[model samples]
Target: MCSLCGVLGCDDHWTSAIARPGIYTRNTDRLARRREAANRIRLANALLEPSRLKIAEWQGASYVLSSPTGRTQVFESLAHLWPEVEAMTARALDPLDPDFLERLKQRIEAAP
Candidate 1:
């Protein structure tokens, strides 16, 4: 008898199938990737103010960030957007800084 039979009420069921090594590994990997992507988006969004930066999809998979002044930066992937968003957030908070625009440009250009 399976160790979890008592808690699950039966030994042969969906849980048993999922317990198989191959299925468990595949499912866990897929779920982990999804969770990581969600967390990345959440962190990026939290760092950027909606009014200052606008993120949009381009060519289905790429992303673009547009500023209030009409400046735009393109990123190959959502993962590449986080650094730009972080720089924009810093600039937004310190707009009067002497080299803010230069640093922001460098940040966007350096993004992958």
Candidate 2:
């Protein structure tokens, strides 16, 4: 149930809609989609951690981005993630910025 709407709802993002083997197909398995969502969250968190922020799956409908201080914003699309993150962290976050990419590369190299 959504904390705001108090109802179970799905706001499927387009990225998932275009996925191969189709989550919308009649025979699609729920577990596979769950795994994909979890994987996406894990990978994004790896990049987000340096900013002291995290994201959580919100009833499989929307994403809940949070700051270490507990501030949170719920968004239904990845398009909204950057602005919400920047608001929470008070820092501009550009995935394509060369300095940011260099930092990401260094983090990957340092990770186990």
Best by TM-score: 2
Taking the tens digit of each residue's C-alpha lDDT, what string does model 2 give over 1-112? 4477542222445566654542422325566656766787898888897788999877677789988888889987666777888888888998888988898899889989
List of clashing residue pairs for candidate 1: none
Task: List candidate 1 stretches off by more than 4 Å.
Answer: 1-47, 89-112
Local error of candidate 2 at 80, Å? 1.8
Q: What is the lDDT of every predicted structure here?
A: 0.49, 0.73
Model 2 TM-score on a 0 to 1 scale: 0.75
Q: Provide the lDDT at 94 for model 2.
A: 84
For model 2 the local lDDT of residue 5 reads 50
